[model samples]
Target: MSPEAIRKFWSLIEETQTNILLTLDNDALVIWLSRQLRREEFLKRVDTRDLNAYISERLPLIRDLAQERLAYQSHSSG
Candidate 1:
């Protein structure tokens, strides 16, 4: 990916993260994030050629973080 594309991709990830945090909408968050990552990974791998491998490696941690975020949102909302 070009520098501009890289910047845009990160910007989008940041925006998506912010939206997820602000809305606490778990369903949409996961789907949207997945789609975004898939699209970017398909166009050009972010850091490696095997994007799925990268995702698989990070998935556990990502899941943990998402669960934690959901828990926090649930507790805070109530």
Candidate 2:
């Protein structure tokens, strides 16, 4: 993925993390991420198949990162 796409991916992850109600199962999360990625202007030229594949592959890592982020935030705040 390009730098812009990577940035946008993290941004969306953070956004999702912030919105607790947006928590979704693995399959639904992948679909939601793919849809969000497609809506990005910077990612418009990228193939949908590639984007979906990329997100699917990284979903576990993404969840880990988001969980870590939340833990750190809660720890720091508390």
Clash counts for all predictions: 0, 0
Q: How far is each candidate from the true structure, as Cα RMSD in Å?
A: 6.7, 2.4
List where candidate 2 sits over 4 angstroms from the true fold: 18-22
lDDT of 1 by residue, 23-77 (tens): 5445454455556765764444554444344344544455566567677878999
Query: For residue 54, what is the lDDT in candidate 1?
Result: 39
The parts of candidate 1 lying over 4 Å away from their true place are 1-35, 38-49
Model 1 lDDT, full chain set: 0.53
lDDT of 2 by residue, 26-60 (tens): 77877778888888887888888888888888877
